[model samples]
Target: MRRRRSSGTRREGRGAPASRRQGRRRGGTDRALCGAGTRGDTPWPVDYRRSATAFLLAAALAGGAARGEGVRDPVADAVSTVSPERLAAHVARLAGFGTRHALSAGSGEGRGIDAAEAWVAARFAEIPGVEVERRRVRAFRLSGGARRVAAGWPVSSPAARFLFGLAGMGFGYREPAMSNVIARLPGREPERLILLSAHLDSRPGKRFDWRTDAPGANDDGSGVAGLLEAARALAPLPRRASVWFVAFNGEELGLLGSRQLAREIERAGLRVEAMLNLDTIGGTTTARDLPADPALPPPGTLLRVFSEGRPQHRWLDPSPRRRLAAGPSEADSPSRQLARYVRAAARRYVPDLQVELIARADRIRRGGDHFPFLRRGVAAVRFTEQREDYAHEHQDPHVENGRRYGDLPEFVDPEYMAKVTRIAVATAALLARAPRAPEEVRIDTSHLGETTTVRWRPSADPEIASYRLLARRTASPDWEIERDAGTAGEVTVALPRDDWWFAVQAVAKDGTPSLPSLAWPSDR
Candidate 1:
């Protein structure tokens, strides 16, 4: 079903005091991980009364959880292999190619970069029934003189066309021969699509030194591996949305391959249901000289979920004032639906997973392949490990402190990437195969002058028990459900809307929630 929620939120940054750190204590007076004191023999965060409320909510969310006294994790066979490992191998192989500069292929007949492209194309063909498509794109090989226009992208938007027209001025024979090789999977429902992609190109140089072998295994090999692993797992499960796995080249050269794909989609009037651009999923933060975020005194504390778009901050800002403006939103796009689904699914599968949504475009200065799709109003998000060891990215392959440098396989961890992939696979499969997007989502504004009434239809899944309604303002990124002591989907939030984009979703008997309703009607 089509799921589009509204986005509204407060944007002013606050001088949040340093968060107090505390260890979780059982039945004690110590504070929980949230760092607040608890009465002796009571739960860390709440006393007996509040604890009972939490337990009831848990039982409501999952009958199994209630009965078993724990969350149920789906049984997944060991995903023994992760994408970053494979990426390291591929990068190592490319390192053997000497140098894959843009224009260097023109000099050597050994088919330097073409050989690399063919190798990637061959891997995709290995996937059963997956077709490999090679697109020969022509752009000016910008060099010293003879600055004349050759063949350019056909029927591109003015902004895109201008970008492309000017982009070539920075290329030439010094660059390696470049093109894009793409592969796709037809999902159960074609209306929605999930894309998994990685850049296949690396920087140019003579010797395959630290300056040459991006070995991009960790940088993007992890991404490709994620895409492939997701496909491998989901092929057996019927999905309502189509999934596309791509190995894009020219990412180092300013996201060239992604640009072409975005323009092509726009030209064809394509519907990109959602994009999970898997870039640099490997390599945890262990670089000896790692520059730290001064604001963050201690590093490597949280697993980050870099989310953007209109509804990016929906959970944090759910109020009537921001109803039309925010909450669990990708804002009137398929991506919003995907985000809501993912957020809900994550809560379902990983109860204690710590995910922080960065309100604006992925981090301060970094960007991912999702950018192109987003520019065209397609829903998109980037999945990267929370902390990055910047030393490994885009650097020429080299060694320091007797430690092998470059995006090597040893640096990438499979288990971490597997967790990331599993959530994605589950979310994609559910969205693609669910009966349809939920029906008739309306925030009950009838009592907006006082109480909050947010509701939606439940999924027909037979196992569904009740529905959960989470509220937040447009200004915050946290979904603070006032837990008065009840089930996950107790219904009808009672929080007063001060400056929020109030939204809600129906929960099925199985404990799954429908995508959030658009913002509630404001009192104006």
Candidate 2:
């Protein structure tokens, strides 16, 4: 869905040179490019010839299409290793657990959530360079009112009964302990993290039926399997930033595990560069009864990425007044930028799969593990199948009226799941290997002019060889143009600031581009 455009009152700066204004306001460190002159209060012309050369050089170094015929991309090689058979096997084993409900009983030997957690942990442990951590999270407790409602589920109306049953699948009165299984592949720079996550819990269509077989092979079994497969494929690669494969619990219980984990990361001051949450990413078709839309891609080839465009928490901007004065940035949230990055990476690496960027947080009121991370101001996005088959999700295995129902392994398309896993692998590997994104990115808004100027602090990574400026029209979904900023921290372009959106990315010496940071308006 498209968001309505918003307009803000324009502000004009006092009569002063752009460079002097920029330098005086933000200290002399701010760089301003003009038509001619030096580093002081003079206008410096943009070296178009040099910028074009750098762009092509960066692309070649990144192993992009510009590279020579024989160049080998370790990232592409890693993605090529995604095995459909391995993905299928992982899904089958997770589905074999019957039900991985957070409050389910069997904690002793080989059943319920505990067994599922142990199995996932063991798989990650088997990876040579990966270290597994079983993090204990707080228990999820159902509210008294929800408990009462679940207990009094009506038996009269079949439709009402089915709806209530589906709602109660993840609800329970007992306070069962939960844990998140984290697998870490430490990078050369361990402080920065790129996370790939999926929930490990499942549920049936019946209310509070933890004992019944929920075999969520497609609901989240597909996602968890994708995470495992990606981790296994990436284990042998050397990275510049850490990559984490997390299997969260209590997701069906209102995102309990992710919420706790997000809080823990915040308390510990962890810097998560980006989070790619894979959830329900295996479906290949819509329900039989639903009318088909010609616009959608034929089943298994399409994937939808949902990201929040507007900040959902107060911490992002404590002052409502300040936010209002800044005009509408509904389309520039960090998560949205990350979503665009995912689409670009997928387009470059997994050409067969179509990545559709959904300009919303999730499907209506429903959410996934990414929500908690987004609320905490982390860049996060969710991967879901293009069309969900309701008949196969949250339903138990049954043959009724000649129709089979259940989230069974047979319903999941392994080839499709592998494509999604490959996308995750490529995006994560590229982000981890690239230099950190430029910081304190800002666009000049002190004066109204036909041309726009952008500035950013240089990346601390000594390997950063150059920077790239990306821009697109306000109505566009993806970046349409790029310019090499060379080694400078600022650049001015002829495009009007009001009509264009801008972002900056740091390029490593190897030509890998970091996740782009959206530039916010700054009076200075």
Candidate 3:
């Protein structure tokens, strides 16, 4: 299930931010380690309630009552519609394909990669208003150690066709057409895309085997099921930004599908606010009933979100690291902030589910479709079951010691899958409905003082009703203080200037918040 290499090799950048050990607060107000190397209580400040109230009052007085004070439950309503039975059914159907190996026959009736692709497309088309399309590209075979393209890649090069033809005849290398299934639900801001994705191909014994039962029920069938369910639920909801539900092929063959898709996205120059990859999110039961990690929540209760640390102000010149030698909070990358948002959504919508934020890019030595987009500088994260059942993933069906083995539907907990699906629905709906984050934010450090002043350019989005000032201690894992700025472009707060770091967020009238735009050191 892991094939892609980290973008660290492709892009020349500063060293990674220093690693910080995450700690859990057992008593008192749970403290969060903020991106700025500070620590503090939750983001609820003393004046937050009053400030929020004041903001609401101002909106009403300004004839914004229609947008404010209106209770909306589109996300909640969509979450409620997630069906466990449907998830299980989808998993079963995908497994029924026998195998989805990347190199499997493209033309077949009910038994190969083409059949699986068609099935997903047909399912999405059943939903009204979904514009479905297939993004097909030549799959590339990577060399050992994932250092270079061994064959069938760089097909756009002028000499690629001639070279590939020779390689096919002389070295028996074949370039297969890998397709990604994309379904879009148009919104008011159609250009800004929020992608929810999963991989479609499966491996039986090894990656190249095409004639074995590779029932990837949990490996990724569970993920694809979640995507389909989210699309069905969010299709009827109100959206401010478009949502693209995607299932990529050939992930087991080194993220080929996602690699091509990410390149296409950059080529088209679309603004992808975020990409969420759902992979191996099926069972809650651990393999051999082993003890769960002491740091993780109990099984059936935790979903792990993996995000890599990157520059907070992605558009910064000379890069974020050059501006701040310490670099952005390794824990507060844009994707990490989005992970925090998802965690918050679970608390509000799926109280029974707990989302564990894994501060690293991905599991050790393992990779997923999210890698391609992450490398491209897009905020991307991967969602997986907290406690993986090793025997149930990437294993061929067999009976060992009288116990069944393989990633089969029987091992999947549909109810758990549904809960995971609800989290995705909540996140997708919330992010799409909220205004985009402020385009620019900065902190004034011209003269060191006991106070800090923050300023930001508000989003042109009419959905933005106000702005919230966020401050976090350097040691806190999350933002600890939030105050409503009431649509102000600048706010001065008295806190020991060097002790706290800050950010600003655009807030919708409904209280939905966009990902925070970190305040960078300003030249002004």
Candidate 4:
């Protein structure tokens, strides 16, 4: 999620220098993370539910999980919070690393990218029950050009197909070399996994230039800081799904690290429930060119969700006003669902800043490591700021129009970074400490034109406090709170209509819920 030079005071200097820092769960998450009755309208794309095609009809028609009545709003408790100041300090430290470009010695011990990788590995080791590994891959070199195509996603139906072709520019360098910084927090159910990630690589070329520091302060520095902040905040809790915190490498060269890891996971039969990718997330005050949806708080908020797949709700002002859309290809990915839950949680806890769920990634033609997960059929989504600052990205250090510009730390707002860290912290703590997601969610369509009855089994976490049923119109972006019945084993309800799709989540008393369970139907 790097930006190119635009006159916009954008997240300008990336692939530059700087420091980095900072900072979630379910019913256990529902109780601890979100307040009751505060769920808002989701900005759904035109065909968001298509991804659930077979899964949808089955869940809705079945006498279980997907077909439920009365939206349940589970109660949540405050898990933990990380200080913005502490998170900001981490971002600053990352800036000091000079260039963390892909193929620049990020692993195998010391100096350059390798030194930074060591630091990341060391930090991960500090977390209890954590295991670390190094993943390798072949990648290409960075684009040797200015910041024009710095920041940028998809299709299916007529709408989806068109956008998909447009965003599918096949960027990323050809096979060169890359590595991924991987870690694991193994939980009881290995089948359900939630991942937290950030790229350890930057854009600018291998050679480091002093003038154009490319400190990457705001670019990925904010992302790394946020991940660290999250780890710090959630370290004390027990989790339902095994959590993975990865500082991905080779993203600057086109998702090399993620691609490498996804294939390995798939090969190893590692079942990943969902993935949350942290890209650029430092800009707040800087105005961004987002979809302009009213449901979203301002861009300055600690969060912004990039939902691909489905048309991500209606677009902002104007006729032919931007109508959001995404394809099951890579755009409407598993991460989209994950992002929605995160937004729902933010609405209840961190109400101070805004967190918009922008329909697409970058402006129109870019993507991040999350795409790899999507390709592998593993749920995944990307997180980043809503603005673009080109002057500082992938460019030589110089000045124009009497404005001294470079990817320097001065351009980034540290306070803004702190907020981003807090959000990451909250999400990780909740996810890590909460119970595993429910399985076999089914909708009760058998009682033709009758009440909705949904049901499912509890996760391995055993201490699940309640189960949540989320029902939304096929076109809505956000999920409405359906039913939050405590886990007394009564998993059935009545829905208003069969037109909408339903999903289930298991929450612990703290607020973290299992990876969401789409209402899966049984055979006729």
Task: Tell me how many clashing residue pairs each candidate has.
Answer: 54, 1, 17, 129
TM-score of each model, in listed order: 0.64, 0.81, 0.82, 0.67
Q: In terms of lDDT, which candidate is strongest? A: 2
Query: What global local distance difference test value does model 1 have?
Result: 0.50
- lDDT scores in order: 0.50, 0.74, 0.72, 0.54
The residue-by-residue lDDT of candidate 1 on 65-89, one tens digit each, is 6557465422122122224445445
Ranking by lDDT: 2, 3, 4, 1
User: Candidate order by TM-score, highest to lowest?
Assistant: 3, 2, 4, 1
The residue pairs in collision within model 2 are 36-43
Q: How many times do residue backbones clash in model 2?
A: 1
| Model 4 lDDT tens row, 87-176 | 567766776766666544533333356667767778777766678776655433322331122211101145543343344354322233
Q: Which runs of model 3 end up more than 4 angstroms from their true locations?
A: 1-72, 140-158, 161-177, 284-288, 291-296, 310-327
Q: Tens digits of per-residue lDDT for model 2 on 114-206?
A: 899989999999989999999976553343435435432213355554555456665534445568999999999888889999999888886
lDDT of 3 by residue, 1-524 (tens): 43433332111222111131012111212223222222343233433223322322332223333546354455677899999999999999999998887666554678888889889999999999899998786655432323123532435553665565455455434456568899999999888999999999888766566667788888899999999999999999878899999998888877778888888888998878888899999964554386646775556877899987753333323343332322255766667777777776776678787778887778877788887777656678899987787777778899999777788888889999999999899888878877888755766555566656666765667767778777766766666566666664666666665677787878786666777777766653
Model 3 global lDDT (CA atoms, 0 to 1): 0.72
For residue 119, give model 4's deviation from the true position in Å: 3.2
Report the lDDT of model 2 for residue 145.
Answer: 39
Q: Which ten contiguous residues of candidate 4 have the minimum total lDDT?
A: 16-25
